[model samples]
Target: MRAVRYHEGGDPDVLDLEDIERPDPGRGDVLVEIEAASVNPVDAKFRAAGLPRLPKTTGSDLAGTVVAVGEGVDDYAEGDRVFATGLHTGRFAGGSFAEYAAVPTDLLAHLPEGVSFEHGAAVALVGVTAWRALVHHAGLEPGGTALVHGGNGGVGHVAVGLADALGATPVATARPQYHDALGDLGAGTVLDYGRDDLADAARDATGGADAVLDHMPDTYLGTDVAAAGFGGDIVAIAGDTATFPDVAAARSAELDVHMMSMSNLATHSDAPDIGPILDRIGNLLAEGRLDVTIDRTYGLDEAAEAHRAVLEESFLGKLVVEP
Candidate 1:
């Protein structure tokens, strides 16, 4: 298997294309012949900030056919198409950037009949992230309102789609060029962060959202705070922040900040029972109720190029690498 790996965390240039031994499935594991994998910010983060352990393979989300199932695995079989995301487990654990990967059966989901390999690969990471934020953390309600930052981003787009399907009005922030795309994705109003003020824009759009789903919470905390309706919640899926805007001052107007890391079994509740979420999203894809957008596609060998594209913020949606 050819994998893009690095001995140390640094710039994207550090990624080296090399042939490595294919991973073998262990008990309760499934060996997938990867057809496509998606590049995410975490892929780059793990490269630039991976553990001291050298020679780490970087990739989380993958879509492929099951070529083999290990001992104790009875739920899946050879030739089954599957979608998966890495759980940050073992060394060489996340070798999805290559032709094969051995993933735990618990992290795997069946790809819907109509969902293409690329779409399956693209949806898992972001879908799970959005589901955790909207359904698990904030408990977003039907007929509620959510203000989403980076509405054009991979996770943000999925959040908008799910929020709409769940009967919430979504207001999103993006660049002017992506405004129409957000609207088409079911965002009731699109605010251009580069051109408009988010707080005022969100307030005017949905009369203040019941919750705010933010990617860069540190950068937009104040705006999200101002845009939230009294007692509304704020969920941050990405970013590292100790505290948000002052809460004591907003008495009777609660502004609680929730982080997606809470979804990790190590920190918060046990890993959610995602079987139902995947089934629902699978139906949405099968019926065209949801759209998985691929901004660009690269061949497996060009994994470094894919990382560079994402690091440079050039792609519009999920960036995929076909093996």
Candidate 2:
């Protein structure tokens, strides 16, 4: 099997395409022949910082077909087409960036009838993160207002669509060029993030955003704190470092701020069964209610190039690497 792995993490250049023996599924696992894998920002971060295993396959999202099943696996069988996040029970078994992977059945999700491999891969990680942030942390409900920083962005775009699907009106910020895209996804109004007074603009757009999904925590954590309506929720879905929030504003508004990590759900033993949520997301994709944007595609051999592109380019959506 041909896979992209890094002996020691440093940068995009660290990722190399190599020939390795294919892995067999262990107990309660499924060996999926990779069709497409999606790269998220975390993949780059993990690549640069080193991983739990040396020479690790770093992709976390995949859309593929089950070619073999290990013991205790019955939900799926040979040739069952599926898409899944490989980080289950917080353990890393080579990510999806390869020709094949042994994924636990608990992490598997059925790909809907009409969704393509690329779209399925694109939605894997970001989709679940957005679903957890809006549906759980934000406690967002229809007829409410959602303020999404970077609304047309990777996770932000999904937040917009899911919030709308959940019946809330989402207001997101984006570069002027992406305003229409956000608007099309049911953003009440897409603010120009270039301006500094976003809190004020968001206020005017919907009187005040009821909930905030902060994608750009470095830039918008304080802003989200300031804009959230009294007693509103603000969920931070990204950011690796500790962020300082406006204590005064938070105290004044009595805002409920929380941090969301999909990784915890993927790895934590106490995490809820994601299969149900994933199934719901699949249904939405099948029904065209949930939206996904596949911004770019690369071949397995071009994995290094794909990593570089993710870092250098301002992609409109998810990036997929096919094997």
Candidate 3:
């Protein structure tokens, strides 16, 4: 099998597609013949900064068919359509930018009947992240309002739709070009993040958002604090650490602030079970209630280019690799 690997991290150029021995499924694992994989910001970040181990395979989320299952695994069978994220898992683990990957059974889920391999792969990580942020951590309720920043990005778009599907009104921030699309995805209000009145407008739209899903908390934390209603929850999914700009206001409102990383949950023993979450997302996809937009697709040979585009280019939704 051919896989993209980086012996040492530096840049997208470090990724090399080379012939490698196919891995066999170990105990509690499933060997997937990867049909499609998606590129994520984490893929590029890990590619450039390096992981704990060297000579690592690139890519993370994958959708394919189970060719074989390891010992102690009976939940899945050969030829079952499946999709998974966090391919860097327990024994026999490898990244998804390959012809095949041996992923742990815990990370695997049945790809719904109508979902394509490309869409299945594209939604894995981003869908899980959005679901965790809005539904799990924030506890956004029906008839509540959700303020989502970066509403055109992968997770943002999904969050908007998920919030709407949950019966909450979604107020989103994105560039002008994406307002119509965001509205179509169920964002009740779409604002430009650059507007000086962003905080005020978001508050007015929903009478103060019940939850704020922030992607760039370093830049938007204060705004999020300002936009949220009393006792509102703020979930920050990305961005660098910065001092909270309005500690007094946050305190006054009795806000609940949280920071989360899906990768951490996938790897940590104390984390909640994600299998059921993925199952719910699969159901939503199958029902056409959740959708993932594929901005582009790349072949295995263009894995390096995929990495470059994911970080350096401006594109909506997810980029997929058809292996």
Candidate 4:
């Protein structure tokens, strides 16, 4: 089997494609013949910081067919088409940037018919994150207003559609070039994040946003606080050291703030079951209610270039790797 691995990560250049012995599935696992994997910002971050173990593979999202199943994996069998975010194992055994991956049953879901392998891999992690932020943490309700920062990025784009699907009016912030596209994806209002009047425009859209989905809380925390309605929910998915610029304002408004990461749920023992969420996402994809835009596709050998594009480029949607 061939895989992209980094022995001691420092940059994208550290990724190398090499031939390695194929892995066998362990108990409650299934061996997937990987067809497509998507590059994420986390992949590049981990590549730069280096993993605790040497020579770890570089991707987490994957879609493929099951070639074999291990003991206790009775729900899935040979030839089952599956897609999953594979970072839960914590040992890198489920890395998808390879010809095959051994994924646990708990993290795996049956890919709905008519969903392409590329779309499946592209949406796994980002889709799940957006769904959790808006539907679970934010408690977005029908007819409410949602303010989404970074509305043209991977998770932002999906959040726009999901907010609309849930009957909420979506007010998104993006570059001017993406305004029309965001509107097409169900955003009722799109504002330029660079504009000085961004918060004003957001507030004017719905009096104030009922919920704010923030991707770069480090830079947008104040904007989120200024644009949200009284007692609104603000969910921050990024920014490790994110802080409120005006704690008094947030407190006075009685805003609810939350910080989350998909990796935390993947690794935590007490995390809620994600199987139901994946099933809902798959249903939406199958029914054409949700879409994942593919900005580009790369070969497995060009994984390094894919990593570079994910971090250094401003492409919309996801970059996929077909093995």
Candidate 5:
């Protein structure tokens, strides 16, 4: 099988295409013939930050067909179209950059009837992240307001779609060029992060949001704290640390501040399981209630180029590779 592997971490150039033996399915695992895989920040992070093990196949989300299933797996069988997470080594090990991947059953979900392979693969990682943030953590309410920062980002895009699908009013922050696209995706109002009064614009739109989804907490925590309504909740899905403008802002608003990492769900044993939410998203995609835009596609051998594109430029949506 041809897979993109990095022997050592440095730059995007470290990714190389090499023929490796296919992985075998273990107990409760399924061997999938990967049709598509998506490049996420974590895939690039594995390379830039360095890993303890060399020859790491970096990718955690994939859409493919089941070739075979290992013992104790009866819910899925040969020829089942599926998408899964945890590809390489983590809570799940989802190395979907290869032509074939052995995915744990818990992390797998059926690809709904109308969803394409590229979208199915692209949606798993970002969709699950948004799902955990909005549904599990934030409890975004119907007809209530949702303030979404970085609405054009991978997870932010999905968050916009999910917020709309849940019947909530969504106000998003993005560049001027992204306003139309995000509006079409259900963001009630779009504010330019660079030019607009983020806090005031968000406050006026639906009179402040019940929940704020801040993807860039390091820079936007103050904005989130300011935009949130009384008793509102704020969840930061990205960044390791945050600095607030003052304790008074959060204290006066009575905000429920939280830091969320999608990786945490996979790493911790007691974190809420995302398997069922994955299925819920799949159904929404099938019903035409959810959609993701693919910005680009590359093959296994062209992964280096894809990595450079993802890390260097600002693209509108997810990027995928077919192996």
Candidate 6:
């Protein structure tokens, strides 16, 4: 099997494509012959900084078919098609950027009947992250307003679409060109993050969004905090501990700031209701209620190039690498 792996972490050059032994499935695992994989920002970060393993293969999203099943695995059989997030449980296992991988059945999900392999690979990680952020963490309601920062990116685009699907009024921030683009995706209004004063723009758009989903915590913590309405929820998927924008503003307004990781430790615990979230997202895709956006695609051998493209921040949506 041909796979991309790195013995040590550093830059994009560290990822090397090599021929390696194909892995066999363990008990309760499924060996998938990968058809496509998507490169995420976290994949690059982990590959460059190193995750839990050395000589690691880094990729989180995949769409593939089962080629072998391990002992006691009944939910899937040989030749079953599927798409899944390899990081749902988070110990790296030669992730999706390869010809084959042995993934625990608990981390796999059945792909919808009509969804394409590229779309499946593109949607899993970002889709689930958006769904959990808005529906579960932010607790968005039909009559409420939500703001999605970086709305042109993978997770942001999905958050905009999903919020609209759930009947919430979505307001997203992006480049000026993306205003009409996101408007088509169900954003009632779009604010250009580069030009507009986000605080003022958000206030005008949805009378100050009740919930704000942010991807750039290093910069937007203050912007989101100021843009939020009283008692609003500001959910962040990135960043470490940082000072509050204005302690007085947060305290006086009673705002809540949620730190979300969407990591294995966060999702895979005694709380077994992951099925409900995945099922809802699956049904949405199955019924065409959820949108799967593939901004670009690359050949399997161009995996390193795909990583570079994503790192350069030139993508409008998910970037997929097809085998």
TM-scores of the models, in the order given: 0.93, 0.95, 0.97, 0.97, 0.96, 0.94
Clashing pairs in 5: 86-93, 86-94, 87-93, 87-94, 87-95, 88-93, 88-94, 88-95
Q: For candidate 3, lDDT tens digit of each residue in 133-179?
A: 99889999999999999898988988998999899999999999999
Cα RMSD (Å) between model 6 and the true structure?
A: 1.9
Clashing residue pairs in candidate 2 are: 90-267, 142-167
lDDT of 2 at 6: 90
Clash count per candidate:
0, 2, 0, 0, 8, 0
Clashes in candidate 3: how many? 0
Query: Model 2 scores what on Cα lDDT?
Result: 0.82
Candidate 3 or 1, higher TM-score: 3
Enumerate residue pairs that collide in model 4: none
Clashes of 6: 0
Residues 1-323, model 1: lDDT tens digits = 88777888888788887889998899988999998888888788778886435677777778899999999999999999888875443322465788888887767788888899999888877887887788877788999999988888888888898899888999988888898888898999888887556678787887867888988877888787788888788898777874657666345577667877523631223566544566667778878877778998998678777888886874456999887
Q: lDDT-based ranking, best first?
A: 3, 4, 5, 2, 6, 1
- Per-residue lDDT tens digits for candidate 5, residues 1-323, read 88888888889889888899988889988899999999888788887766636778878789999999999999999999999775645645547789998888878799987799999999998999888888777888788888888888888888999999999988988888999999999999999898657777778885867888987888888888778888888988877677777689789888898788777766677886557778999999999998898988998988888777777777777999999
Of 1 and 5, which scores higher on TM-score? 5
List the global CA lDDT of all models. Answer: 0.79, 0.82, 0.88, 0.87, 0.84, 0.80
* Model 5 global lDDT (CA atoms, 0 to 1): 0.84
Task: Please report the TM-score between candidate 4 and the true structure.
Answer: 0.97
Q: lDDT of model 1 at residue 188?
A: 93
